[model samples]
Structures are given as C-alpha cells and as structure tokens.
Target: MGQICPSTASPLCVGHRHLRHSLLSHGRSKAPTEFPDLSFLPPEMAISILSHLSATELCLAGCVNEYWQELADSELLWKGLCYSDWGNIDSFLPDGMVPIQSYKRLYLLMDDGSSLFNGDSVSGLEFLLNNGVVGPSDRHIGCFLHESRRLHADKVLRLLQDRRGVLDELVGLLDFHDVFLPDALRKFFTEVPAPKVRGDFLEHLLTKFSRRYFECNRDMGLPQDTTYVLCYSLIMLSVDLGSPHVKNKMTKREFIRNLRGAVQGTPGDYLVNLYDNIYLHGHVAKKSHYKVYNNADF
Candidate 1:
C-alpha cells in the first residue's frame, strides 16, 4: 500500500478530515451518494438559521463545503457573532478602520488567551473606585472583593469605601492563591449555587438594573436590555458548551442548565427556553424578532 495518510499531516489533511466529517455529521459517508441537499435552501434563509447558531457552529459550518464556507464566513454573519460575543470592540480596535474590519480579525483572534484571558482587570476596580454607578454597589463590591487575592486586597482596602463590609464578605471567597475565584468570579461560574430568583422577578430585575447606570443605557431605558436578555437567553448564552474548540462536545442546552441553576435554582414560565440556549422567543413564541415597541412588554 502507498504511504498511509495521517489525519494530522498538514492543511490538506485538515481539509480532508473536515470533508470526511461533513459527510458523516450532515448526512452520508459517500459524497456522490443520494442524500438530502441542504445547499438548495435559499442562502438568506439558511444564513438566518445559521445566525441563530453559536460562534463555533458557524465555523464548523464553513468546513462543510466551499459554498457553505463562503456563506458561513460572510461579513454580515460574523458581524452579529462579534457583537453577540463582545458587545462593542471600539476600544480593542486599531485606528482608522470601522467595526467589522476588526471583527473579521476578531473572529480569528478571540480564541487567543493573551487578549482577554490574561487581563489584570482594571475596569472592575475602576467601577469600585467610582463608588459604583449607583453608589450602593460600593457595599456590594467591598463585600465581594475585600480579601480577594485577585484584588490585591491590601491596595483595594485603602481605595475602597465600606472597607469593613467588603472584608466580611471577602472572607467567604478567599484562598491563599490567585487561582481561587472571588465573589465576582463566583457569579459567572454556572456550576456554583446561587439564590433562586422569585416569581415575577424579571420585572423586579429590570427595575433594579434600570436604576444603575451600568445596567441601563444612555437613554436610561430597559427595553434594549430586556430584548437582548430574551434574545440571547441572558447569562445562559455566555458559556461555551460543546465548543468545537474544546475536547468535550457538550451541547448548548446542557450548558444553559448550569447557568439557569446558577441564576435561579427553581424555574418560572418566562425563564424556560427548551431550545438549547439559542432563541427563547424566536420561532415558538411567534413573536417578532424586531424592536420592543412597549417598555412594559418585556
């Protein structure tokens, strides 16, 4: 036999591996065999469905074939992915170019550990130093950060208000090393337990968040926040489940179960989205995906 082709050889091998994968994952083992032709679907409709997919899905979709790759990597699709992942990137961009240009590169670079994974967190400290957007967050921050090794607790103790309370709260989260999660870190960890939010709590949350400058917007409205929350399924979407980039292939639905439990251990009608943390209100609710007309509608 000729030299056996190793799957790990080169770029060409990578492409072949993807080709082999596409056949199995999507439909058949043989390319020319009779099978369902998904490519015949209108491109716009296809891309829209693809848009509802996570960042990793769109990348994997690109590997399926040339036409699919072109559609998957289109500027329009990647733009939505960029905004969904990082809100706004103006601060992260170089001068003299608009957002999508940075987004094009961002799609490739987001996986780089050095960009976000290695930051020293000046922004969180700045918020605390500002006495926080609503001032009451001072207590919250202090309680959350006092003994935090990540906070350089000695330095934060001098700069922050409510030093006593922060220290008291900080004791619960502290450890000897920088590796331990602070109270702030604990909130984002889906596996960690959190207090259950009560019934009709979304309204209370919206109202509470609206008062804070950090939570609401320049217009001081909750509509944008509310809509985004419903669309992205809140903190549930921020996680990486079954990430093509990772060794494990857990689904996004499984991922959101962790977030939902962390956010509120018990559930309510408004919070349930059986759709794998994608669009909670998109197709099933028969609701328009456009703007929120009434402020109270959410």
Candidate 2:
C-alpha cells in the first residue's frame, strides 16, 4: 500500500492552488467595464449636454480628464453661460469692446468679481479700485458695476469720482457707461425720494436702463462729461415723475426734449426707453421704487 501525503504537501493543496491561479488569470483576461465615454459623443452633443451644467459644474467636469477638459473649456459653452447670467455683453459693456479675449476668461473674471463683491471680505473695494491705477479694460469695469449693483450705486460712483484717476482710468478704457448709468440711476432715485423698490425689480430695471443708456451714449457720440450731465438729467426726470407738485405726466417727446436740453445732445432713444420703462411699466409707484432703484437701477 502507498503512504498517504501530509496535509501541508497534499495533492489536494496543489489542485487548490492551480484553481486559484486559473480564476485569477480568467479575471485578468477580461477587460474592465468603464463608464460611457463622453468623448465618444459628438462635440456638439457633448456641449449641449454640458450646457445643462451650471458654471460651477462645468468647471468641475473639466477636472475629470483631458478629453473633458477640452470640451469644458469651449468658448461656446462659456459664452452661452455669460449671456444666460448677464444678458447681452454689449449691453453691459461698450460696443465692439471685447474685455477679455476668451469667453472663459471673461466668465471667470465676472464670477470672481461677483463672488468678491458679494462676499463678506472687505478687500473687494480696494481690489476693484486697484489703488487708482489703470485696471483692465472696460469689460472689467462692466463686470464690477453689474456685480456690485447690490451695493449703493451712488456711493460707488462717489467713491470712484473721489479717487483721482480711477474714473478717468475707467473712461479711458471704454465709454464711462459701465460706471455712469448705474451710478446715475441711484443718484436720480435718491434726489426724487420715491418709494422704495423691490430688490428683484431694481436689478432688472438697472440692467434694462443701462442697456438703453449705453445705446444712447453710443449713437450720439457724447463726450464723457456730457454723459455725466445726462445722467444728472435722468435724476431730474425721476424728480419730475415723483413730485406731486408737477401734476402733469411728461410726454415721451417732452422727456427727450428735456434730456437733450440738459445734456445738449440727442438722447432721444435712451430717454424714450427710460420714460417708457418708468411710465409704462409702472416703475414709479406711490410706495416709491425710489430708494432701492437708487442703489440698483442703472
């Protein structure tokens, strides 16, 4: 009879090791199941899908891989995001002025500006003024004005005007509309002492008014000083609207005529838009959209 092998050196142990090796080899032979490759999709389709992502999400998606990074950095995606959040770029900025060359850079700048201004940090004002030195293009100024609309527009303008060369630096880069319109709107409402406006409506009106103001300033070729006076005229118009002593509703034609006289330039389209926004849209109410509008509406 043959002797039995010890348990440690048994043929059964050898068989078990062979089985384990076979299983391991089998597992290794099969390919890994990966997630669907976004890169496999058409570029347009991928962008369309990415468009659903918020600015923050889009930025995060870029971190996944190089393929995603390429698509995530797309100009179209960033540009759409910009328009969605801030509306027409030309409306917020001067005509034909591309503040940052890339939409991605502009979006980042705007986002950073919004966060910095809205955040609790005290450095926002200093950063924005950049110590009265020449800053970036008017695009940056537009971003500053648009983002900081939550702050007192008059106060911001006053601060800028008080700082030597800051306002001039802004004016030199692009037309002063980026700063002027928002500041003027606030100044107007303050002087009128109209009813306080809701925050939402004030933001809307500021954007709309700024867009119209920009168009007017562009068409008339008005100098910076003239634009400044024109902003003052807008304040006077607000006074006329709010004053019960005036009694008569000023006609659109009359409003434009008055603005022209005050600024000594044709601000017809702008004044008409302004008059319609206030008179037709019921911007001026007994409760007075005045106070909030002063801080917000451009």
Candidate 3:
C-alpha cells in the first residue's frame, strides 16, 4: 500500500492533477481587474480650473457656457483697453478690425485735448492748438476742456478753427451777449453774422496769445508786477465768457476790482502802463510770457 502511494507522486498522478488545478485557479484570481471608471468628477471643480484663461481663450471657452460668455465680455477683462498708453490704444486690434478705427479716433481726440491742459510748457499748448486746427468730434472731450484750466483761450479757438474752420459765435463763445447788452446794442450785435465776428475776434486774441501776454510776467525783470497780469487775465477771461448774470453773480467782485484797482500800484512802471493800454484800450504789449504762463498754470 505504501509503494502505491509513492507512485502517485509522479507527474501523471491524481495528487499532481489536483496541484495543477489549484495553481490555475490562483493565477486567475490574481489577474488585474479593469481600471476604475473616473469620469464623474464635480462640475464646480472643472469650472474653477477653466476660470484663469486669457481673454481670447475665455472668449472661445464662452461658447461652451452662458456664464463664460458674459465673463469674457466684461470691460474689466479687456486689459488691452484698460492698460493702454497715451496714443497706443490703436494697437490692440484683432485681424479683422473695424471698431479699432473708432476707438483710435476717440482716443486721439481726447489725448490732444488733454495735452493742452496738463502740459507744463508752451510746447504742449502749441502742439494742441495746432491739432485743434482740425475739429475734435468727441463732445465729452470738448466739454471736459470747458471746465479745466487745460488750454489757453487761443488754443480753444484753434480747435474750433480745425473743425472745418466754421466761423460760429455760439460754437466758441460761452455766453449770451444779449443779456449783457442794452437793447440797442443787442440789436446791433444780432445783425452781425456770428461766424464772422468769432473769426475776427479769434485773430485778435491770437495776437495776445502769441505775445504770451497773460504769462507770469515776473521773470521779465518785473516779479512784483507779475500778479497783476494774472489777475487782469483772469478778469478778462471772466468778462469775455461771463454773461450779465455772471457779472451780477459777483460776490467776488470786490476781489476782482481790488486787483484791478492795484494794477496801478505794481512795481514795474512800464508794465503798469502796459496793462492800462491793453486792459482798457483793447490793445496789448508785444511780450511773450510763455514760460511764465506755463509755470503758473502747470
């Protein structure tokens, strides 16, 4: 019986057959299962990943979702427009550009107007005045200049000139002349063409602007007389632009009249004489206060 058991250890024995079956079953159990399905992540996490894309990329991605379309079109997202340099706003256009030209025109007009206001010298004023020889169509920009000490009155005329050189009184003048005039005077003034009067007036004003008449005047060896020039210039401007209502609105008349009164007391004898000739006589001394005016306003 022991001899029979020994023989079963050979390759063809039933014990050997059982061992083969066990090995086969163990190998099948160890085989790798298919990889776990990983496609069901949260939608919020996916959106968070996509939020940091650039403007163009965001634009394209917007086609994929309503929220993205709105975010992409936001003005805050337009870094190109927001960070644009003085005249460089034109460079941000895409290949099929049409709106770019509109943006450029607006920006250039605004820049030209602003330069005259913030500029520290006659150079900027002259440049802006020259540009104004052509019209600036942006009404908001024009209105902005109206409120700021940005440009000399002459420069404002130049801009009107450039706008097709239309001679218009109401276009440039900021007041109602009739209100300030007697009825007879108002009738005479109304008979004149506004454009012709404005054109003629502009020419005369330019001569004063050319002479730098309203500049500080202090450095022309007459520092003590400088303030008079400024005071007179301010009053003259107020008179030219102000209506009778404005003059009537003068709680500040004492201040203005006092300065006008002191015009005679200024240290420079020649300058005092000059102010009388110009302010009262409507004539001006031919002197350039470009540097002086620039310093005061700037």
Candidate 4:
C-alpha cells in the first residue's frame, strides 16, 4: 500500500481466486450431509449391482468373494433370466435354457408344468412341433430330438412317423438324427427305399428306431434278419398314428414287452434280447410275414 504496487495487488487477487477454487473442490469431495453411510448400504442394493453384470462378469465376480459365489450360483438368478428372456414366447422351452445352471434346476417343472410360456403342459413340445426344416429359422428342434434318441427313441420315432407326410420340410433335422445311424449315409444311399421317398425322414426315423431295436435285442440270439424286421415293423407301427394305430395309452414298459413278443422274444412287457446296432443289415427276416400290429397305427 505504501508503494501502491499494481503487480503485487494483481498477484494477490489471482492467488485468492485459485484458493477459492481449491476450497470449493475440497468441499465437493466430501459427502453431502444427507448422504447415508456407504459402509452401511443395504445388502439388496449390493446384489442388484452385481445382478446387472453379464454371465462372464458374474463368473469373475464369483471368484472375488465367497458371498458372490453363493449368490451367483443361486438358481433364482438363472431362472429369472430364462423366464425374462424367452418364457413369454409361444415356443419357448424352459429346458432349452438348460445350458444355464439355474434353469437346469427348474427344467423338470418347466417341461411338465401347466404355467409354461407356451401355455402348454409339455415344455419344448410346441417348439418342436412348429419349427422344422420348413421353418425359416435355423431349426434346432432336430438337434433336440437327436439328443433324446437313446432315452426317447420310441417317442421320437412315433412323432416323426406322424409327420412323415411333410418329410420334405424336415430335411436338416433328419440329417442330424441320421448321424446316430451306424453307416447311416451308406445305408440311406445304397440299400434303403429312402431315395424314392424323402430321404431325410426315413433316414432319421429308421436310424433312431433301428438303434433302439438293436440295443434291446442283440443278446436274444435272434437271427440277424429277424431283428431287422422287428425294428422296421415297430417303426412302421408307432408312426401310423391312425384311428386303429396302437394309439391307446401304452407305457414304455408295456411297449417294450409287446415289441419283444412281436420280435419272437419272451412274451413280456419289455425287451428281452438287448442288442446293439452293429449287425443292422448283416441279417434279414427270412419270411417277412410278421403280423402288422395295426395298419392305422402307421
């Protein structure tokens, strides 16, 4: 003030402005007075944050803490995703979501329950029915059937036979199922009536049914030809789905019994021989005169 120094006064004013800004920033860094303590945040809020993450991220976070691993593996989370993602669709199968561990836990109910996404009791059944090689999509129904061939062969063979009239539309699916057929490609091209009909339909149905027959009859010691006839006849009978077809309710046990008897095995309600597919074409029925159980059964 004695010197009346303009430079000094200006420097002081600038320093004051800088100090004000630094103080403001420090004040902002502090929590608002109304803010709750972060350390005391509710567990629900924490879970919600974690739930927003992707599957890979969730998996990674699981490794970060034991609590996270428990939450991540909770079936509720996966089932919620399944229901939210595809449960509303007409063709959604909860079992289709089995790749997710949580959904797998609910798979049995999803498949059999009435509150299904499709409003149908059979979970994936609608999806399998509507989509096929004919559907514009990639048609995964065939893949599903192929996976069930061992346990559900009778069911699948019957389903395809019912749809044989539309076999042309099921090309891709038939190809997939045919993979289970030993030497399937060769048999379809060289020895089967498949060339005349839709090759895919015959290929799929025959391969699957034939495999089942072989597994159930090999040890019965039936001549090779008798076994082939048995398998083929069973395929034809189940698929007919006609008024007179064996459409009456028959459990797997009952069907197996009748099938074994038809093949000249012990007259019981289950397969007696239990063979494999290695000898499919090696033998042939000498008479081919086995009674057609029911032409309407197809």
Q: Quick one: best lDDT, which candidate?
A: 2
In model 2, the Cα lDDT at residue 53 comes to 93
lDDT of 1 at 85: 55
TM-score leaderboard ranking: 2, 1, 4, 3
Colliding pairs, model 1: 142-166, 143-166
Scored against the true structure, residue 94 in model 4 reaches a CA lDDT of 28
Residue 30, model 2: lDDT of 83
Q: What tens digits encode model 1's per-residue C-alpha lDDT throughout 1-298? A: 8655674566545444554555677555445454333365556656776888777788887898898888887788877775565434343333344425444455555433212222432444443334221124334443333312222322332332224344333333333122211111222121111212323433433223223322223342224344334333432332223224545543545544644654453243234433333332222111121111101111
- What is the per-residue lDDT of model 4 for residues 170-203, given as tens digits with 9 covering 90 to 100? 3333332324323332232221223223356554
Worst 10 residues of 4 by lDDT: 286-295
| Model 2: lDDT to the true structure | 0.53
Per-residue lDDT tens digits for candidate 3, residues 1-298, read: 4555364364335444544455565567584344211112223333444446543465576685566564445444343432333223232222233543333344345456456444432444344445442223333233333333334444443444453222232224233232211221122122211122324443333333223322323234423244335434543443443435444432334434545555554544443443343344331221122211211110
Q: Estimate each model's TM-score.
A: 0.30, 0.38, 0.21, 0.25
Each model's lDDT: 0.39, 0.53, 0.36, 0.39
Off by over 4 Å in 2: 1-40, 60-70, 73-110, 119-122, 125-161, 169-237, 243-298
Question: Which model, 1 or 2, shows the larger lDDT?
Answer: 2
Q: RMSDs, each prediction?
A: 20.1, 16.4, 25.7, 20.1
Stretches of candidate 3 off by over 4 Å are: 1-109, 116-149, 152-178, 181-298
Q: How many residue pairs clash in each candidate?
A: 2, 7, 7, 16
Pitting candidate 1 against candidate 3, the one with the higher lDDT is 1
